[model samples]
Target chain A: MTLTPTPDAAASVLAWHDVSVSIGRTAILDRLTLAVPAGGLLTLVGPSGCGKTTLLSIAAGLLKPGAGRVETRARRIALMFQDSRLLPWRRARDNAAFGLRCQGMPRRQRLDAAQRLLESLGLAPEDGDKFPHQLSGGMRQRVALARALAIEPDLLLLDEPFNALDSVLRRDLQDLVRQTVTARGVAAVFVTHDLTEAIRVCDRLVVMAGPPGRVAFSTGFAQPADARDDAAVLAGLQALWREPAVAEALGATPGRRRVTA
Target chain B: MTMATTAWIGRVTAAFLWRGWAVLVSLCLLAALWQVGHEVYGGLVLPSPMDTLRALGALVAEGVALPAALETARDALMGFGLAAVAGVLIGAAAGLSVTVGRLLEPLVRFFLGVPAIAWVVLALIWFAGSGLAAVFTVVVTTLPVVIIGAMQGARTLDGEVLDMARAFRAPLGVRIVDIYVPHILSYVFPALATAMGLSWKLAVMAEVLGGTAGIGEGLSLARVNIDTADAMAWILLALIMLLSLEGLVMDPLRRRLEPWRATRGQAARERRS
Candidate 1:
């Protein structure tokens, strides 16, 4: 979860050292070096095909980097993909406890933990026994979240996990993720294209450039911890939007101001 | 007593009986045509429906058909069970490994293309009028279909669900039983059901061609006697046995394994009020 060190010092849980990945002779991630501080929420933001997903894939051990090493102190890791990916055959609670059940946990224990998580996420007790098709889209995503959390993972990776939800539901889920991950103290790396979601949920932001993805920019929140409004966060985001390198990399007009404060 | 309620009941009953009536009427028309053709021909070239039914009833009364029918059922079940096991294993392997799929593709296609007569002749040579002829016919006719279904199921599985399983480091057992099995089963069951029917038909052909004792043997004997009505009667009996066997074995098992298909029967009460 949260690792707070003395002022000006930070701890690291997951790190990548000069990682590069190639697919069919084409480089996808090139010299992508990143260090995620223990218990900090680091958000990766970039345009499509910019290797944000690739970077997360390598970190989760789903893909091996061709040229570099990834170090992870967290033995338990959970990844949430963009599609929610609920198994249509399994009931919601069984889906939620998938990892644990896969880990050979006792059925009763897994069921109990799954039930608790479903309850925490506002799913009815009976709803846990219903199949995925019976649940709405928002409910499916919530079940996916519950599945990941049931493992009690020390590290969580999310790839645009809330993209399918409407704006209000998205905001509500963002708040839920914020509160849940903080309470659990899990280190999370969230990938998103939404600038506002990045500002709201991420403690730090890393942007990547394309073709052979490289870290293009890194920034901290401009607003103090007390201010979480759209206006204050939008000010910092607007500044990043104006960066000539960011604009050039993103293929937008190099120095245009779209938001005024 | 409300007229509207009575009319509503009448309409519902009519809707249900319409399809049943259509099926019954078609069967009656077919029998009439067969009877007229036999009368016009004035020979055993085609048997009249009454003649065939009388012959079938006499065969059953004399207990001449029970043993053959029982033997045929046994062979069908054995062949079908073997095919299901082999099909699922090969199908899963093909689905999981591209290399396996590539290597087996030609073999699957070849087996699928192999004529039923060719297989029957080969099986006759190998098993020589034993139960294996029937079993081999069933396997040869059905395995490829199940394998194809399994491969398709595996290919089309959602990538995200797979990634989730991998992220958790799911073991082989969990991966198959949970993630892969359910996904593939929806494909496998229908294929297996259809295959079971094919297995019975092919088994009978194998028995007939291979000179094995069973319903097919009885049909062959009727042919030898030049008893056209008896042959037709035996064929009808075989058809009835096949349908009843599928209803008794395959249908119940499928309904149990795939309860969602019977949603109206069990889950109707659970619908949101």
Candidate 2:
């Protein structure tokens, strides 16, 4: 479902207009204008070092843009890293509840909330009691997702959250994220280098190229949800690669066939 | 006990036995060396390990060493407590502030380079033979180490984790207490262990130089009387004290704080026990 936010700037869950960022005398992001409406997933996909992460950080309000403005109509925001980033000392339930714990929620209340969230995300009670080290990679990612969702965030920023996961786990978590976005109406921007993954989980896909990263192409996920199988996505990707900037960003010629992991 | 509990206990016992072999072997080697030294140097200089233990027993029997041990223990504890508090606070401040860290780095180096004896001498003059002088010496020698530990901890905090906390809008107090403090302790514990060992040695050294009680002062008295056996006994007692402090206190504290790093399966058992 596409929710085009009202023209009023205040209505958008997140909006970044003409944002530029530089680090240590090196420009990292050019003028970048992007917005994520309430309950939409906008994925930014590009080659490595294309400043996708920098842009996501700007959207997440972690890094200030050197040029232009970022705005959000969110009271709560959550960011998930590529790594689970679960506190090692805490068990899964506690790790999930950490954000709430930081917000000064009562222990019993937050733990109960987190446990329920974990259950909803397919974690068993025993799994929730185990420490992060004891959990499998997929389980850890699930717990991290539970942690982010526990805040009931209005805007969520995920930095290649699925990149480290195996294929089965990746698809499962991608579906979980899609379901979460729809169920909670959380605005999200997922940054990744994997085009197939970007197309799979996102409602819209953005291609960026960079010395200082800027969007080169933007398009909605065209296939119907059921037809978005691997073959369909890969077939549509050939036409996308024909655009000069897209070809360059993808490091592929128009005639060349590619399948990115 | 349940089967699982019994199996866990057995695993723990087996684990201890595994580590015990290395300890037993090391002790035997050291004992062999010590016995050889006693035979070579005779009783005047190098007493047998058994003779040193006998001398230690005699000192306790005469009521000469127990009070001294207590005094030294008190000094070490007080000095260590003072060092830990000051070191963590100052180190954290320096770690958090580049200017503060830069300004203090030179002084830390200067203090670190100075010999412990020099500090003991200065402390005696400053405090005029009080227990404070003894403690001051221990603090002077021990504080720099823990400070370095804390500074490194502060500098090396994972930026990603902090960013996650920030995005969650964690309160300032929560960030400081939970995220910052726990992260800082990863570096602080090892430094703290080093500081603990230094405190006891420095306390005794300071007491020997300036005070009228404690193991150091007693050591001086033994030296004056040319009672090498008693001096050796006091040395043995100090070693025992240091070993016991690490075994009974520091190791347990570390395990409690960082159970995750312990044996993965046994961690729960250790925590429960």
Candidate 3:
């Protein structure tokens, strides 16, 4: 493993230096180099087989690349999956406090922090006392987001966390996540298949492709995520679809059909 | 205590009492059935519930009941405690590894297939009139049940939740306590309750055959004397003890340990009510 030093290595919260992974004969991620700038929301958009979730797992240090190194300045990293994955036996507050509990924070302090985070994420205070089964899908996801945020992580890895929700709920959670990440100044790498969703929330977007996944195209949105309305996102999506490399990487037929948000 | 806590305690007490009342009603129904049987079959064949109670009272007055009950309780509980601890440790080890599980499965099945009576007979030969015979029979008969429960619990643990725990970097100790133990207990508790009931039955049976001084021995003596009421009294005593242990101890302990499961639908119903 070699670390190709970058000028902004100090500014970036996390950097993957020529990271490659293989499972048996199949190459999952091939020499994929990427970085998330401090406090930036970077979205990875791609087709199904492109190893987007694999990238997040590597980012979270849950999986090691077959070659190369993942370097992160962040002391604490939190990953949120598509499913809530909250412990059913624990109440919402306790679930939210899980990361803190793992870190050996005192019970009272962690619970209080979790309670505050849950409330900030639009969950009612009383909702924290309810178990995962008792909460609505949207509410459970909110608790999950609280769990991710409660650890005060420097880097956040999200794997299509809002995918299972309805479109409206998805949009709301997207806004909540973007706001939280920006407000906390935590760098985040979000993996999503939905190009429009990516355009809706990200500061910088990278399009990935192939069984041996590699970045095909990447761009930065000058307009802030908070400023991007549906029209702005749709326009951005159309513009991205027009990029030959992105359109090909995403396996979409270019100029044949209009893109819809 | 706060008013809310006091109110919560009151509600719980009320629920407990309501359940106790239902149990009492069932017991009364059983007693009525016994009275009908006694009237039809006469004194030699079946004793009335009242007569059986009187005989039980007489046994207590003669100081024969309490000591025998205590002796049987000690032997049964000792075996159960050993089996529970060993089963959980061994079963968890087996469940965690495919090779270990495969190796132990048939051995456990063989042990389970052997009838409790057979174990009792073996224990009689091996222990030769020692109280260890009863304890040995109880453990051999009940260990398989607890082991299977724990194995199933460990084997069926949710992989996704475990992944979540790993991603969060939960420590090994935390993972065991928060994830493994609670998850396993859900599967193991029912098995334990079953084993607990079996332990008492096997203990008494072993005591009867092995000639140990316990409720089983008391029943044997009554049988030899041909006093049907005395035998019925001993049987009644054993049933009451088992029921009380289940109602007052095991069930309550399960509810306490698994409050999340205990309150699942009941919480909603309680809110509605």
Best by TM-score: 3
Docking class of 1: acceptable
Clashing pairs in 1: A1-A185, A1-A186
Kept native contacts, as fractions per model, are: 0.56, 0.54, 0.61
| Model 1 DockQ (Cα-based) | 0.39
Q: Which candidate would rank higher by TM-score, 1 or 3?
A: 3
Give candidate 1's whole-model lDDT.
0.82
Clashing pairs in 3: none
Cα lDDT tens digits, model 3, A115-177, are 998999999889999888778789999998889888888899999999889999999999998
List DockQ for all candidates.
0.39, 0.49, 0.54
Colliding pairs, model 2 = none
Interface RMSD of 1: 2.7
| Whole-model lDDT per candidate | 0.82, 0.84, 0.89
lDDT of 2 by residue, A137-222 (tens): 89899999999989888888899998888998899998899888877778888888887788777776778888678888777755
lDDT by residue for model 1 (A1-261), tens? 111222311577788889999999999988888888788688888888888898889988899999999998988888988888887778899999998988899999999999999999988888998888677778888999999999999999999999998999898888788777778888889999777788788777777788689888776664432346766566666776766666666667534545432
Better of 1 and 2 by DockQ: 2
Candidate order by TM-score, decreasing, is 3, 2, 1
How many clashes show up per model?
A: 2, 0, 0
